[model samples]
Target: MHGPHVVVVMGVAGTGKTTVGPLVAEALGVPYAEGDAFHPPRNIAKMTAGHPLDDEDRWPWLDAIGRWAHERAGYGGVVSCSALKRAYRDRLRAAAPGVVFLHLTGDRELIGERMSQRKGHFMPETLLDSQFATLQPLAEDERGVAVDVSGSPHEIAERAVAALRAA
Candidate 1:
């Protein structure tokens, strides 16, 4: 928190990473990027058809986000990425060594309900299980914090900010 840091707001679908990421960035006076926007049309189409993305399907998207994080290295920025695996996070860190993660954690039931309520999102509730299955929580060595996603977006963002500051 002493200097500029790129924070990746990461979680499974429906975790509100998109909503909370910008708020976190604003609170820290930084820019925000939507992870979904980096995905190619084919990737979006696959997900929209209810197929989960494989590692190969995600590499380019991850790389794009990583590049964005690398560009914001000296100037802080926030971005929403699923970052479900440690390898994905590693790829990001390789691009931007100072990148930190803000992982949103929540129960499947709550997240599924949220996903179902959301409109126009490519990701479907059917893929929630695959998301959770692929998720690997941050390791002790990782520079990140996991926040419970059981509150208002403002409250969640506040918690993320406090935790990131503490980190």
Candidate 2:
């Protein structure tokens, strides 16, 4: 059998990473790991309180997620991460090479609206601006695809699966 096909469903907050990650994983017959689940308590508390995490706060979290990806390699898995910066993605790649990224994108207003309507998530609507400010779209050489998140979750997941296959 081929190695695990690890895909990171990524984007700014409220782009539907949690909703779409599992769908993509299910479609691909892989396990799904929620990115938020990997965040430490402090990180969650900080975000819950409307504070954006700095690089110092992120490296260890990213490393933990990367470790999960590494362990799941050759077995197939999907994970959701903000992966808002190229450097962050690079860290993940360093830990698990050949990890594909599915970058969900949408308009700020739409995303903000979605954030406002969501419930029980640690990330707040107030941090939406910081997320976008820190976001760096996938570079030309990155192993990923960008899928617009304007459609329903099902549609978005289907599009992401199609893009993943093509990639």
TM-score of each: 0.99, 0.97
Point out where model 2 deviates above 4 Å. Answer: 1-3
For candidate 1, the per-residue lDDT at 79 reads 95
* Reference-based lDDT, each prediction: 0.96, 0.93
Candidate 1 has its poorest 10 consecutive residues by lDDT at 1-10
Could you give candidate 2's per-residue lDDT for residues 1-167 as a string of tens digits? 13457899899999999999999999999999999988889999999888999999999999999999999888889999999999999999999997989999999999999999998988899999999999999999998999999989999999988888877
Between which residue pairs do clashes occur in model 1? none
The parts of candidate 1 lying over 4 Å away from their true place are none
- Candidate 2 lDDT (Cα, 0 to 1): 0.93
